[model samples]
Target: MKKILLNLVHPDINQSVVNKRLLDGIKDLENITINNLYQKYPDFKIDAKVEQKLLEENDIILFQFPMYWFSSPALLKEWFDVVLEAGFAYGGSYKLADKSFAVAVSCGGSKEAFSETGKEKKIVEEFLYPFEITANYVKMNYRKPYITYDAEAGLSEETLNLYVKEYVKYIKEL
Candidate 1:
């Protein structure tokens, strides 16, 4: 079985209806390490060694976060800066090479809202290109991202539960 490291990067997961539920749905799964970044580094002081160790240990690195300003949250970006350093993730042995990298991002707007016909005038994939670039640079296999749309639009209980299951399934398949 592949050991998956799920890096949960919500700034305030407790108050998040979508992300919190998704986290709860898969927290008990075996062979998966759920590292809550915000909870671990509330002061924004990241331990690069510890983070790199986690990357070294897992077969898959999955980033789960809400799309903020068409990009990842601040801590996730900080993680990219500190953890993916030389001699570890790139420019040397490339520790992350051949490992699978993927993202599970929740969007605040509807799917249509991200299209040219809608408000944003661009697709969701356009916003997620940076992740692909990073994965390519590290030589990791970039998998298709799993996205939850209309997250801030207040999904119904049934819809939320469905998405939670889908998120779990996506992780398992990864």
Candidate 2:
């Protein structure tokens, strides 16, 4: 099994419903390393070298977080900005190629809201284009994202439980 680097980012996970549950379900799984960014870097100071080292050690990198607005939380973007700098992730002599890069995001809105007739009226993938592009640019294999709709105040207990199982299964498969 490939070593999975589960990079989790939640500004306030104590209040998260689905995301927290997802974490609880998979926290003990084998061959998986969980990195909770907010807990590690409360001051938003990302250690680029350490992060790069983690990236180097892991085969499948999973960026798990709740969708903020239409993109990831601020620190996640910051992680990219700092850790994926020249000579390590991209540009000269650097290509994090062949690595599996994917997102496991929680969306408070329902699936319909990402459809043509809904509120955003744009597919969820559209919002995730940046991640895909980044993966491609680094020559990594970008997998389809994992999403849980209505994650905030909507998903029922049964549905949340099902999603937790699904999430664990998905990560294990990867």
lDDT of all the models against the reference? 0.94, 0.92
Give candidate 1 regions above 4 Å deviation. Answer: none
- What TM-score fits each model? 0.97, 0.97
TM-score of 1: 0.97
For candidate 1, lDDT tens digit of each residue in 78-139?
Answer: 99999999888888779989999999999999999999899999988889999999999999
Cα distance off (Å), candidate 1, residue 59: 0.3
* Candidate maximizing lDDT: 1
* Model 2 root-mean-square deviation: 0.9
What pairs collide in candidate 1? none
Count of residue pairs whose backbone atoms collide, per candidate: 0, 0
